[model samples]
Target: MKNILLACSAGMSTSLLVSKMKEAAEEKGMEVNIWAVSQDKAPSEMEKADVLLIGPQMRFMKAKFSKTAEEVGIPLDVIDPVAYGRVDGEAVLNKALELMGE
Candidate 1:
């Protein structure tokens, strides 16, 4: 199972997207553990994640977290603003899968 971690300002904004992503994953028969955490909690959570997706609003934190993600050997990227604004879970999930070279 792939562990997908999303980091935002408060961890609340991504909850809906998380649900949608879960739905998309289920439809695709993919087994994944996805969760969101506040930026402050992300570093601790990264170790358990297979990939890290940062919320558009928290894009600045990417630089800060890149090193840790690199050390963990996971892909890290900012969510597409358009997809994020529309809460397009499938697109985001595809992006994550693409990043993982799936």
Candidate 2:
């Protein structure tokens, strides 16, 4: 199963999106594991992530996370503010896949 990691400030808000993403994945017949984590734990938690998407509020951390992501070979991107604010799981999922070059 593909692993999609979503990281935000405290991991709380993204939890809501995680459920929706799981639903979206299922609708597409995808066997995937998706979860959310705090920015503090994201680096160590993402070793197995096929793709990592950070919250727009934490976009500044991209450069730092980018270094760690490169070492682990995980594609990373910032979630779109519009999509995130609306909690549009399909849009976020599409963005993750796009980042992964899927």
Candidate 3:
């Protein structure tokens, strides 16, 4: 199973996104471990994440997250604004896969 890490300012909004992504994975019969955390906790959680997705509001932190992900050899990206705003789990999931070169 692939492990996906989502980060946001406070983790609250991304938590909702996590649920949606989880549901999307379930519907597609994909086995994936997904979790959401605050930006501050992201670096610590990087080792366990196959992919790192950042929320739009926290997009400015992409460079920082990218550096951490690079150290861990993990793929990282910013979730699309439209998809995130509408909670488009499948779209985001696809984006994650693309980033991972899956």
Candidate 4:
């Protein structure tokens, strides 16, 4: 199963996205573990993340996340704000796969 970790300001907004992504994964019979967390919790969350997805609002952290993800061999990218706001799970999932070079 692919494990994806999403980070946002307080994790509240991203949590909604997690639900949507989970639904999309289920519909496609994709075995995935998607979840959301605050930026501060990311380091610890890395243990289970196959990919690290950041919210647009936290774009400033991309470099940092990238460096950390690189050290751990996990792919990382920012979620498109429009896609995120719309909770477009297919798009988000595709984005994740793209970042992972899948």
Best by TM-score: 1
lDDT of 4 at 15: 81
Query: Which candidate, 1 or 3, has the higher lDDT?
Result: 1
Question: What ordering of candidates by lDDT runs from best to worst?
Answer: 1, 2, 3, 4
Clashing pairs in 4: none
Error of 1 at 82 (Å): 0.6
TM-scores of all models? 0.98, 0.97, 0.96, 0.94
Residue-wise lDDT of candidate 2 within 7-27, one digit each (tens)?
A: 999999899899989989889
lDDT of 4 by residue, 42-62 (tens): 878977888999999999999
CA error at residue 82 for candidate 2, angstroms = 0.4
Per residue, candidate 3 scores C-alpha lDDT tens digits across 6-101 of 999988998878888899999989999999999999999999999999999998999988888999999898899999999999899889988888
**Candidate 2 similarity to native, TM-score:** 0.97
Q: Scored by Cα lDDT, where does model 1 land? A: 0.95
Q: Report the number of the highest-lDDT candidate.
A: 1
lDDT of model 3, residue 6: 94
By lDDT, is 3 or 4 better?
A: 3
